[model samples]
Target: MSKICGGIFTSHVPGIGKAIAQNLQNDPYWKPFFDGFDPIHRWLAAEKPDVAVVFYNDHGLNFFLDKMPTFAIGAANEYRHEDEGWGIAFARPFQGHADLSWHIIEHVVASEFDPVMCQAMTVDHAVAVPFELCWPGKDAFPTKLIPIAINTVQHPLPSPKRCHDLGKAVGRAIESWGGNEKVVIFGTGGLSHQLEGERAGHINVDYDKFCLRNLAPDPEALLQHDTLDIVELAGSQGVEILNWIAARGALTGSVRELASNYHVPISNTAAATVLLSHSERVLA
Candidate 1:
């Protein structure tokens, strides 16, 4: 059976993608932010999971206010990145693992987590940016991708507990699949910063650091946080940390933090990244 070997957690801010695309990694202003991913690249090269179950949220790209899903999983054979009007371009399309996607859909749904199965979806920066950060290359993505988008944009977002529960279901689904694919789950978005209203530049670096310290081994403790608390402490968009919680839940058992980083003002957002490995080796 296919098994989830590990997971990656990071922010999906668009500015980071633009800096890398423009080759500004060496610039002092951007160096510290870009430098954080170096260890991730090495880790990706070493682990090289066959498929990445990327957990991200759409930002007014595909699902608008008209319709939004609380939880959605992409079952497409291929996914093309949509232009979020940023014009920061040139990441190739992502290849999707359809068989594994279907297997996961079946098991996850049966496991009582009802996620809308998307066969065709145009991914936005939420999906593309983080992919570039971890597996930077132009030819093609080194690993196939299965995007699981959570509804962080809408007001009535899922609770942190719900996201974590769904993630655990996904981990179970991946493990139950009778395939040899090595799977890695990713929870992308948020270290803290609100991008709207009078508090456009609000950031809570201390809370973000606190989250980073506990996310690996004590994710359940974070479930105590509600949307209101996150907004007040972190910022309105700061609730995006729910994505990180979901990714943490997918790791299955105890996780070892391989690498972690944090940077503020990555385009008005406090971006962060953490790499985790399952304490017990998961073999296919």
Candidate 2:
């Protein structure tokens, strides 16, 4: 059984993760976030976690409206970065964690959650951007990654209950994996930001605050409310909480908030960042 398991919650607002990485290295607004992540970085630097199972959704950037996978697992050797409808593309190609990834796929299959396995997958900003923030250097962050792809941008996304079930299965698989000591799970996405219609630039500081508060302790309350209800309360794109629910489930113990940051009216969306870890290795 794996000895240690934890989670990192963050915002992938375009270049936001990169910005935080810089803050860890320098900037003022980002220092707290960077500081909170320091133990994580140190843990990464020391334990050299063998596997990192990351959960994120794909926008239209990689999968389009015509064909979308509710859940996809990339068993590829490498992943390329792409644009989010913007002219600019992220510069690096992300490396995949193949061994553990395949292990996870097979484990999930036996457990009855059959995810589509892709030998070669191209990830968009949704996955790449936040990763850039979390692990700035490709050569840094020692673990191989298992990318859990969720679809939130397209219409008719998966329900909260479905995502929650997936997380439970992920926890079971990780617990079953006969592995080394280190493992980190990440759920990357939003805290109440809408990216469509005149509702663009919508600021629900109240909703965002509620989410940040509830994310750790009362997640079920958030989950109990329907996805449509959350979307209504949190704007369409705001339904990204499904990703976090899965991350929350993957963790071994209670959730602890280490650091948090929120800013509003950035381009067409409200932006925020949150860093959380499982309760156990609080000192690490």
Candidate 3:
């Protein structure tokens, strides 16, 4: 039986996790963060997921404004860095696993979810941050990655319902895979914050926590709302909540809240983290 080890929701605010993980490597606030993750760490150590299907958004790094996709999947054997306008600082271009990725595409499409297939794509902070967090020290994980890129930075963005539908497709796809390796489907993004234009330093702990409370099970309830509502209440860029809905759709039943941490003001972003695993019942 294939079990979803768990899911992680983090802000890929470029160097946030890297810095936090490094600081926590030998610090106190680490407890607020790392300490909560002990159970997940133990689980990770034990289950050792063989693959992670990640849901992230790109900031016009790989595919430019020239042609954009609402959601895209890598269909190549290897993916390289796109200069990112700063050249490859992290240097090692992220590699892709074709067999499993193809399987996801085949199965997801069979479920009627059509995702844009990418052969050549570069990545930006959205995708980079999460990968670095999950595989700090680089070769630590014995898992292959399937990146699902959502165009969060650019508009005419996909509707919340669309994202949730994609999530259902993703979970269904992974469940159909005929493999023995454990897989963790992660959706990376925000709880609540705005980092652009005039509203730059936005932070609402109450809203962030409220989101965490509703996110695990009642996320579909959010889809009934629209962009105007989100931009007005959660900040324009805060529309990333769609990423979380997509994640929730993939994992049904109960979810165990593993680790959670929230921080204010981190390099043009407000940040938060939460780890969830499929529970026999709802997370408590």
* Candidate 1 positional error at 223, Å: 0.8
Q: List the residue pairs that clash in candidate 3.
A: none
C-alpha positional error of residue 177 in candidate 2 after TM-score superposition, expressed in Å:
0.8
Ranking by lDDT: 1, 2, 3
Error of 3 at 219 (Å): 2.2
Clash count per candidate: 0, 1, 0
Tens digit of per-residue lDDT, candidate 1, span 1-284: 78676888888888778887788889988887778888888887888789999888988777887778999999999998877776654559999988889988998888788888899998888788888887776768888999999998877889888899888888888887888888888888897988899989999988998899898878888888887788888898888898888888888866899888888878888988888887444465
User: Would you estimate the TM-scores of all the predictions?
Assistant: 0.95, 0.84, 0.85
Point out where model 1 deviates above 4 Å. Answer: 279-284
The window of 10 residues in a row where model 2 has the poorest summed lDDT is 17-26
lDDT of each: 0.85, 0.70, 0.70
- lDDT per residue (tens digit) for residues 1-284 in model 3: 45577787777765555465456544543344434345555666777887777788776677778778788988776655455554444544566677778888888788787689887666666666666666656463456667888777777778888888888787767776777667777778775677777876666666667777777657766876676666656677677777777777777657777667776655545567777877334457
Report the candidate with higher lDDT, 1 versus 2.
1
Off by over 4 Å in 2: 17-47, 84-87, 137-141, 265-267, 279-284
> What is candidate 3's TM-score against the reference?
0.85
Residue 131, candidate 3: alpha-carbon lDDT: 61
Clashing pairs in 1: none
